[model samples]
Structure formats: structure tokens, C-alpha cells
Target: MIRTLIGALGGLVVALLILGVLATFGVWDSIGRVASILGGLVLGMVFGQLGIFIAVWRE
Candidate 1:
């Protein structure tokens, strides 16, 4: 559990660093619409996978 937490935090840090670089290049400014679309895509995938697993587990 602790390892999972540490790994997640490290991943977040790396993501932030990459975002910082993108922001410096002005990619952040144009990412508003893309961000929403990507977030929705990821959320859909995550929940969809969870729903699939639960359905299968119920069998």
C-alpha cells in the first residue's frame, strides 16, 4: 500500500514536470478543450473497465 502511494506520488511529480515544460512552450494555453476531452476519455475508460470487471465477477 505504501509502495503504491509512493509510486503514484512519483508519477504525479513527473507529470507535473512535463506539464511545466509544456506550459513554458505555451501548450498549456491551447490545451483547455483538449484537456476536457482527454479527461472525459480517461474517465470513461476507467469506469467502463471497472464496470466490466464487476459484471464478470458477479458471474
Candidate 2:
């Protein structure tokens, strides 16, 4: 469970980093601020679930 939590946190961090880079490049400008934020959250959730799955599978 701890490992899974760590994986999810790591995934969230990675997602935020990716979002930051895209925002820096003006990729989210057309989408607007709220939509961009929501998208990032959704992306983070997906990555987090993937991380959890990997952690559980490895064990």
C-alpha cells in the first residue's frame, strides 16, 4: 500500500511537470485556464492509476 501510494504521488508529480512544460510552450492557451487545469487533473488521475497497477502487479 505504501509503495502504491508513492507511485501515485510520483505519477501526480510527473503529470504536473508535463502540464507545466506544455503551459510554458503556450499549448494550453487556446483551451483556457480552467479546462487546462481539469485536463491536467484527469491526466494525473490516469497516470496515478497506471502507477498503482504497476506497483500491485510487480508485487
Candidate 3:
């Protein structure tokens, strides 16, 4: 149970770190696509992992 929580939090932190790096480098300044894609990808990964955790816990 704790491992699952750590995994989820770690995933979220990593995702935010990626976003921060991109924003810091001004990579999304001229393009909106990258920001949107990154946001969706990170969020999807976080939620996906959450679902997996819940399923495993239930079993």
C-alpha cells in the first residue's frame, strides 16, 4: 500500500519536473502543442498508475 502511494507521488513529481523544465527553457513559448501534449501525457500516466494501484489493492 505504501509502495503504491510512493509510486503515484513520484510519478506526479516527475511529471511536474518535466513540465517545469520545458517551461524554464521557454520550449513552449512559440508552440502551444508541446505544453498541451506534455500536460496530458503526465496526467494520463498519473491516473493510469492510480487505477493500477486501486485494482491491485482490491485484489
User: Best candidate per lDDT, number?
Assistant: 3
Q: Whose TM-score is greatest here? A: 3
Candidate 3 off by > 4 Å: none
**Local error of candidate 1 at 28, Å?**
1.5
Model 1 misplaced stretches (Cα beyond 4 Å)? 1-25
lDDT of 3 by residue, 1-59 (tens): 77877887887788778777877888866447776776788688778888988998999
Per-candidate Cα RMSD to the true structure, in Å, reads: 5.7, 5.5, 2.0
TM-score of 2: 0.49
Residue 50 in candidate 2 has what lDDT?
Answer: 72
lDDT of candidate 2 over 1-59, digit per residue (tens):
66666666776677667767777888865647755676678677767777777777898
TM-score of 1: 0.54
Ranking by TM-score: 3, 1, 2
- Winner on TM-score (1 vs 3): 3
Candidate 2 regions with alpha-carbon error over 4 angstroms: 30-59
The TM-score values for the models, in the order shown, are 0.54, 0.49, 0.66
lDDT value for model 2: 0.70
